[model samples]
Target: MTTVGLLYPGHAAEDDFPRIEVMIDSDIRLPLFHTVTDGDSRGVEALRAAGEPERLAAGVEELRMAGAEALIWATTGGSFVRGWDGAHDQVAALARTAGLPASSTSFAFAHAVRELGATRVAVAATYTEDVAPLFAEFLEAADLEVITTESAGIATADEAAACDAERVKELVVAADHPDAQVVLIPDNALRTAAYIPELEERLGKPVLTANQVAVWEGLRLADRRVWAPTLGTLFATREPPPGIDEHRGIEVRE
Candidate 1:
């Protein structure tokens, strides 16, 4: 069994990990550890606090004991709000602390975009108007063109988690662009795991979401490529995506 540790922020939508684990029908395990956040707010300060070393260290210890071969920080806002360099540093430090390969959701999105060989992407974010641009910027830093970004102005993870499935679908539809190669929903708090197939069918394009990418990132770090079509295009094939060796943020220690 391949085990991946998830250092999640707050309590919203974390169930997506286990849902994915079951859907994959493989020995892939996603064990989550909820990290402390400052009120689970979407503000920059709160996001930064969520990825703090102290909070992540605690989660890392728990997951290591769980036999996690790799670790991921499963929050888009918590990592991207710090900008590109900060996010890289965050994962780098996480790797050092855990003595294992580590990555975050922000980097996961960038890597997922490359894995799909997509150049342009549209973002459907649950962050506030002020916080949404940071994700676009983060994508741009990875050299992927951001076609457009639409924000839902959700103030906190609690608010995002409470949104119904139809509302989530509406947000994704509004964010799609004819020019975009993929549609990205970049909030771990929002529940998009169950709607990936439906949304991708409606859009006729790949749809990448926060929790989905986080799980994929953990597998990538573990050098585990799995075929899970229900999870969407990212996991539909076991073949290596283009640039698989390019821009992997840390050295995965065995």
Candidate 2:
């Protein structure tokens, strides 16, 4: 069976792995590795622990030992809290160490938007108010326009995952801008993995959530991307833009 690696934070958000496995069907395996994280909160200590190069390498190496074919740094804030350049460096380091294609949730979000050809986006961030703006900068750096953003002011990963889907969808709608062509929920802790279709139906536009995109990016790197009607727009094939080469998928350049 095909296997992909997930380098997750050391928090209590337990829905990710099982949800991803179900989303991918029984055809693939997800080797989960937890990188150090001091708390479920998104603070300096949490960021340092989650994104530290040496610790991250340890997790990647562990996944490599598990025979993973590709790697995903599945923590959104962990990757984006460092600036755009730092995020790029973080994923590059992982791919070099793992000797396989790799991506972080931050880059996965960007690539999913580009692949969907949606330039104007609304962000429903599940971070604290102070922490949410950083993702706006990250998206801008990725060349996508953030029409608007809203934060749920959630303090921890566990909190975000346990947040009800209706509430999350409410935040997504509140975050929506008149120009928004797509809505993005940028938190791997979030449990919107199964609600993609319903969310899109309510908003009348594509909704891309963190875990959903991470799975897509994982399959993408493994050259296993195929149509999955349940994954909403990110799984649907679209024409690549002028410069991107989709078959190779998400190169961070080691």
Candidate 3:
């Protein structure tokens, strides 16, 4: 079985590990590390520390020991809050430290959108409205256009995890614009694996959710593109990518 390592935030993203495994019939192994964090006001320290190079290197080592062929820093805010350059450097440090292929959910979202041939996107985010703009800016920096954004104003990881798919769908469809080519839900805390199909069908466009794209990114790193379809058009549609260089990171594909 192909093994994918994930540095998931403590108190967040617990269900995603199983969601990916169950959603795909690839028989892959997901080894998770509950990353060290202290949730404080605005989660400033927690997010910053999660991307710290020294700390991330250690996380990569732990996953390496578990035989993970690829790694993902699976939190959205922890990566994007740093902006594009910082997010790129964070994954570079992980790849360098572990001497393995690496990617982050932030880049995964951007890469997924680019793979779908979309320029304009609508975002439904679980971050506080104040912080949601950072994600929009991150996407813009990655060269995607932001058409609309809706934030649920959720501040805590636990609350974000507690969000059901139906509520999330409501937020997503509400945020979608007539001209948007895709709808993105940008909170790793959410359990979005099972909702992508219905959401996409309803929106008449692609829906890229945090947990779904995060798993897809890791699987792509492991070179397991056609793992059998479950939800979303991605599983049914994406062809094997030209390999991502372990040193160069994921390509901003055409």
Q: Which stretches of candidate 1 lie over 4 Å from their true place?
A: 241-246, 252-254
Worst 10 residues of 3 by lDDT: 245-254
Looking at model 3, the pairs that clash are: none
**lDDT per residue (tens digit) for residues 72-100 in model 1:** 98988889988999998898889988889
- Displacement of the residue 171 alpha carbon in candidate 3, Å: 0.7
Find the candidate with the highest lDDT and give its number: 1
Give the per-residue Cα lDDT of candidate 1 at 215: 91
lDDT of 3: 0.79
lDDT (Cα atoms) of all candidates against the true structure: 0.88, 0.81, 0.79
Better of 2 and 3 by lDDT: 2
TM-score, candidate 2, is: 0.91
Q: Per TM-score, what order, best first?
A: 1, 2, 3
- For TM-score, the strongest prediction is 1
Better of 2 and 3 by TM-score: 2
